[model samples]
Target: MPGNYVVVVVLSSLAALVLLLPPLFAAVDDGMRSGGKCTNSCGNVGFEYPFGVEDGCYRGGGFNLTCNHTYQSPRLFLGDGSVQVLDISVPHGWALINNTGMVFNSTETRVVLNRTWDQLVGGPYSLSGSNKIALVGCNARVDLRARVKVKHGGRGGDDDTGSNLISSCTAVCPLDLEDMTPVFAIGSGGSSAACSGVGCCQADINLDIPSSYTIQIHNLQELGGSISPTDLVFISKEEFSYTNDMAFGNNIPQALPALLDWYISSDPSECTYESAPDCLSANSFCHAYDLGYKCHCSDGYQGNPYIRGGCHDIDECKSPQDYSCYGNCNNTPGSHICDCPRGYERNASTPNGCKDIDECGHRETYQCYGECINFPGGFDCLCYHGTDGDPRKEGGCLPVKHHLSARDLGLFIGLGVGSGTILLLIAVGAPFLSRKMKDRMRIAVEVARALTYLHSAATVPLIAKVSDFGASRYVPINQTEVTNAVQGTIGYLDPEYYYTGHLMDKSDVFSFGVLVIELLTRKRPTYRTDQGDSLVLHFASLLRQGQLVGILDPQVLTEGGGEVMEVALLAGMCTRMTGQDRPTMREVEMGLENLRVSKKLASHDTASSSLVSQMAEHRMIATGDMEESSIQYSMEK
Candidate 1:
């Protein structure tokens, strides 16, 4: 009996899992009919739902597993030799799977893994959601296409709210591939060990799974290069640790019960035509699938409507615990009712509805709290002294004037005036504020110079005249404690900079990117959590896909087509992490001159702007100073 109950529980669990299907399940059209004898078994594993060996068994398509009986024990396998699944986990959304003996060497510092969609050889489904693409190697670069779900765009973090986004994470590390080392961080990097480039990598999936996946591992020294051939790529169903040993470079995830979903796209005409009465009762709704429509009782009812017998009504009154009632509960055939207790009069409108009798008017049932008021729904509990009328929301009402009379107020004002005089006297000699202001001005000038010099004179003239001169030279904002919350202009802040307050021209480049976006479209570099769109991100996405015209500012697009593309590419270069990689205003000028001299550019030139000229001067000073400082430091060391 215990075993029988266990079997039933197991069956129920499996049944519940089949409810959510993948997008590909749009192909299935029929229910399965297994005549009698169960066929193959791998030890304790039984072939079922999606793993049957023959046709007319699986409920959908794209799930094919082969039972290898070549050895004494039978083993399940995917087509060819992609992954070897070890076990299936229903409670925890994972499958114990691993890749075969392919290895990759970590000659470079990074490797890549992918969470790809697979159609188990025309069986009946595809796996999805938060699947981990594990790259067991050192120095990994995991580039992923984390797209938004087609249906919904974002994920809600709280328990009650809906989700907002399907996200992906990438991890990296550097270690000895043959040492079996965990590849933890070597020293101190600002990033945590979780993703601090020591060894492991992970990415989050947006809500929807794409049709397929593209994967590549790049060498930081140069792109489109690979490490030695000892590393292995695996899409794990669970978390996996990296080993520094030679084997780890080649260890892939073990294949097992990878979870996939099946969907009934439309109502099945076959099932509906074959069993009209039994399939869909008067009270039921028809769900058309690829094969045929399956029948079920109406929303409020449950039972076997697929059989000859009629679907029975569910009695909500059978158990008082079934329905949510505020007071006395009464049962009906398909629903329940509630009634208030004795002294409370029955309310005709709401269920379990009741109103308290006005006993205070009769001077009987309630006690007093300052004063009592009799109302239709209930009695009011009035309170005094730091209280309000409603005991729940506003505790009680207060009688004003227990502290601070007019005399006390006047005395405090006199004290404040005395303190103000003393502070003003100190302010007369305070050099700290002035010093700080000078430092801020100094930093601002440096930044202004970097920005100006990097701009092309022909495209954006470097004007020396300061019109919007919000910044002053030789004055330091550092003198004051108040800081810059957002240092760069909207378009130019680096996307890579977050959580830290470090400021420099690189951050300004991020802002410049925003400016480029503005030049392309009329939008600013603003982010709305409610609406998932960023001007910079939108433009960057277009550029990455080589869709320049789609994002180019219409006005600019009409003026110059080919020139716009070159400028966009230049803007991208300016945002590079290495500030040295950015072109100096002079270099930018030479590049621009090439186009103008070639007559491929517009005749008008705005490159000699004074602002840009000032920027060029500032850069000349700072870059020379920094380079000399670094060289001296190296010599001293």
Candidate 2:
């Protein structure tokens, strides 16, 4: 048993040791990969990965740099030369260098020429296409030449063709300084416009796989009568601003800022799987350039791509300017999640991703059956007008009861009795007039009821009523019936029917228009204005001139508000001079019905309040409660 136990213990210990070895080795490997002796910064500029001041730290010989410690502040240079390095971007693969310009002078016999350049043969650095070649001075000319790479040949050869000459420009001074000064003042604000061939000229450079390049400048005019100013030619980086003083004054810079592009390879072939070794970082990708390849961090990653575990996921929640999140934001690996608050929703139109949800627009979802008012994130529901309760639920609101005084009720009954007595006396005194008025009122009610039924059913079936066979005539559809005598009342007759002795449905429309005018004005159809014009004609004229308000009844003005004008306009259309010009009976009915519906909607609150008041008064009268504290009355006696 002891022998068996010993073998078991040995086996268990070896299993534990095997599991621990992998992580321990990984830690040591990570330390060795990150540990390197390198100076990362010089003066005010800093750089990382791929570019290093020490020999073994950089990725290749072309990326090697030197740090000069001879000055008060250390200065970094590209290779072992005087070309000082001002800035370097590792991810962008570009560097800014301080480069000097070439100057030329005029001699007694001829023009003296000068040339200045840095050899870029067999190196990672290439002149950026964004740089501009500028010539500054009177009658100055400058030429730029390059040795381009050839695809078929192993090495490039010098060529004097136009393709090799990348850029050239000439500058001339204006004879009148006064005129040029104003133009120069405006151009000095921008660099491209400032070099307008007046004492300065600029030309863009295009280099197609250049192995080497040179610049030469000389005076174009003969040096005989007047000695020209010292001519200068230089290359400037993208967006480098030039001013009038720099060209005219003696403040021209000895060196200008230049951009140099750097890449991984010089070969033009596409990269293979084996060539992706440079993008060893966890979240890095390899992109093919025109002449070589470059490494870049993935979409949500940032930092150096040439080193292992260099790129890191970005925290989008902290960057509000770049990534908008209105509500709670949670960051995850390589991405982020944004959740809007309770009553908000996603909207691209808003600056933030979230916007307030209009709960009132979607009433069913919010369970608000009554009046709903929307706020920022929530809504309020209540009974509109007078009744009170939670309007969000069905059948939650109820009508309230009101009371009136006993003395006020008595006074209301007395007025009713007196009005009835006066009307009874009038009816007895004028029996013929009263009968005619009653017959007309009955006819109008029947017509209104028929129109209401037709609209409610949404279908039209003719339902003719014959009050008097003498005045009624059957006219076929789409036909006119002629009569020897017009039988309608003088004030309500259609002018075309009376004059032409022709009758149609439009004749009834003209009479209805007169009736509508009488209803609104509370005047008889035969009533005339001071000018002796009939009510229909006067109403039409007043409606066209927007003066219907003066003739409208006080009751109509109080109840109709703005809607009265629409009805008046419809009446004017129905009362046109010719029966053919008037609207059909069906059209007049629809117009009146539409105006009525609009009025109902507009006065919804007011009508509700009035109904509640009337109901309360009836409740008081039924209960006979005179001294109740809650009861209210319009009159006391």
Candidate 3:
């Protein structure tokens, strides 16, 4: 009757398990040792490998740069500004970056990329999902699109030609955006109708030549552009000022920028696999890279062949310590034995790694029991801050506490349950308790206005479910079938209140006129045929058999003939079986506010064979004890 779907699934599963469970936090990881280096601000930029700036420090592939001395102007970043490293080359396999853009050729049609349709596998360095992305001026329009593929040369082509995926498209650009330039493309480019909306679109990648790749640009506009841009034909002409909300034809912009590709090893034998074998030791060797490879400690070993007393010992005589070795120390075979001596500083000293100082450290002869205080490669137990158990490092003085109120036991259990539920409902208010507290305060104000209109329409997901009350009543039936029997639901009832079950407010306007004919026919008004008839024929028999386009909903006949004759004359006055020829929800809310102020009516797509031959079902001009032409002022005492 009034939505008792098991009390809305036991109170929405106890309010989603007491508001979606709590205690979250867990991410510590301590193997810590980062990489990728930087250094470059403007002009002739060259930052290299996996790109970077002072995390683990870089020096490798894809020249990972990141040296922005807080830009009094230095800027280089790649892994922080979501991509901006700007230029690096080993003869250009491609990594000349800068918030690189390649929303798989901004589409108008077939374009989808949730990471290239969820990449299956047998993979090996690939990136190019069809391209074209220029927006340099003129009211710019770049509605992005992507849904790429071409795995291992499909359409049958290369790898001697053996990697099935084959072609895909969507690369548009231009809505009078004045000749845009600043390059962008990934997969199937060049012709397929100017592949990424003129401005020279292109996509024809055939990767597997082992080189990392990371592509992901789409809908990015933090007040117009700069997520990724650096295709290095020696700085693709300084580009970066096309900001009309960073174009996806002006929409999908949250913040974006992406591009990644960094490979030097394709692995063949640089070592061994199936997990640990040739981790090269006898003075490190194996190196090959084109399929995959590794190793090199030869002339002087360094550390880690994946570890287990992992390699070490390369100490020539460059002495920053005994490991940096200054004088006579050349050990050879990976010579991991000679550096470090003469004023040490190569990571400064373990805990933070590498060190060697002895200014006798703020000495009182190394202050043996308390204050040695030295730094940048040295000692500091310092001591003196109300010493208690500390000469330097002891239990010291602990007790501090202060910051405690997580709302002090939720304000003492809401003022002790608001003084025990108002003194136990006024000590259980004397018997039958005023008609059970007036039907529990009219079902708690109609379940709090139907849970505040379903929590303010939970941000519109819309499948539609209904019926909270219809002026509440269960079964006191008998006033002559309330004038011929009306309750509801059975092919969303209301064919004139299923031939009159009377009760009015137009019986909830004939159940919202069979829910706007089940939201304009995603069909379900009824269908059975082979003599089971009534597949809801009749909106006067599909308006006199002009079959109101086989029962409406080609999206409600493309909206606007006065909004489909003001919602089919409010589903023909909530199914006129004459309940005073229906109306009133304040005359169907003032005839949908004068069909939304007659915004030039012309739009109803279905319902017409002269619309139910201009509607007519007449009979109950109005009387009493309910033959409901809307109960003539209710008086049958």
Candidate 4:
């Protein structure tokens, strides 16, 4: 009877336990469901709404994550089973995955690794910016090839073509350890940490992996007897450091983190609002990525953008640590504002968002030399220009020293003599400099105008292709003719005429451009250094590189003012690669004539102003003399 009672009690307890379990099971099941309300986590890694572990949990097939709990810890795998998922970010539209190790050949002389995107077809995943091909070892060479298969015809068609992109990188050890000593000194554990022309080298993988890509390493030569046969050449998402100990470690983890960019739409044409994926939430925008489309939350909002109503307004003012504000912080709907207090000001480089006004710092406004009293909004100066001493000290203003010793008087006389000499030199040299500048300008304008007239205005238009002023030929308009085979000066000869024996009006334009350059630079046309580089070529190169200032004559630049730039630009345009591109001689003449007229007008205006000033000064002196004479007459009477 006692045993029967115990059994009844156990049965009653089991029934109570069953009744309590249903609510708990329902709550757990709801948490695992997909969409915005679902729990988005696998083991220690956290994923967003677009990436989930179960069916109907993720946005699409490409974003699916398979949770394998058979191991000691749960592991999330990509749908293709080629990579293990590490982390996913909705804002960046990227996921971090683990890299696979390289496979060594039977002879150990070569290693190969591959990344395939076959399972990602018609999906939104692609290898993005975070990956790079790394080659590590002495005298290691890497051959990287990216191959993608494209369907040529319509659906179900057998037409297909493979496009391949090939590139290579080589890394070699230095001839001497001393050459690498500096690099080793700054590196951690005396390892060559940088991938720049050392035992390790890296090249960026810019192309997306659509079908497959391969990285093969060959020509692995040993450096010294200590070189390990386990040299690694692998694709890395994160940068790797090369150390001597890594070569000796058993089963070293070659897996590295790689970045994958994801999109919402499989077909690019369907990226429009009417055909967009249902996962894209409100306040989100779509962008083209690789062959598909990606969704991003608008600015000022941050959350799971692929979920309905997931993105929320960011309260910037509430998080003062994230937003910068010095005085008053005001938060708007999508942005924030920083304003200065009453006594402060705002500047481009204002520290901590606002700068306090220092009224005494501005000598022109406060005008204080001895003492300055500062208030909340304004300040007052105790002493001004005549006073001498520190501003903050009491009774600081004192009479300036006026008495002079014999040495001070001698110094004053020496300074006066020096100043007078400077004034005399300026007064004498200024006119000479001015005259020299005007003469150069006038000569340049006259030469250009003469060339223009010969090419266009004369009864028989002449092409002055020859360097000598005496040599010339007549050519009428609306005619294409070949000139007699004659060689002119080396640098001045037109390249087209020299090659094809054809001469045109543009041939003279080329010569004129060379002449202008020579005049500006004050150098001979055929001038060459020991390197056999001619001045014409040098000048052209300088102009092309925007270093015309370096080759310009110092005197011309100082005196020509803005006209120098105009002349340089005109010369550059005239020296075109082909005759058709060069400006006509008539155009050149008009440019020079305009520059000359402007210069003459400016000089005339300056002279007139100087004459007016002299006349005014003389009239004031004459009026004072008359007043003095009147006063003298009154005294005599």
Q: TM-score of every model?
A: 0.31, 0.50, 0.19, 0.44
Evaluate residue 221 in candidate 1 and report its C-alpha lDDT on the 0 to 100 scale. Answer: 24
Which ten residues in a row are the worst by lDDT in model 2? 1-10
| Tens-digit lDDT track of model 2 for 278-301 | 777888888777757788888888
Query: Which residues of candidate 3, in runs, are more than 4 Å off?
Result: 1-270, 273-283, 286-291, 295-637
Candidate 3 lDDT by residue in tens digits, 512-608: 4544444444344454445443434344245433356666655346443335534544564454455555553334433443444445665532323
Number of colliding residue pairs in each model: 117, 0, 96, 1
Question: Roughly what TM-score does model 2 have, to 2 decimal places?
Answer: 0.50
**lDDT of candidate 1 at residue 201, scale 0 to 100:** 52
TM-score between model 1 and native: 0.31
**Candidate 4 per-residue lDDT over residues 78-119, each given as its tens digit:** 653445777888787777767665343333333333333333
lDDT (10s digit) by residue, model 1, range 62-131:
3334567676776654332233445543212233443332322333332333333222222222335545
RMSD of each: 32.6, 25.0, 35.8, 31.5
Q: Model 4 segments beyond 4 Å from truth?
A: 1-37, 80-82, 106-119, 148-167, 173-198, 220-228, 245-251, 273-275, 319-324, 342-374, 377-637
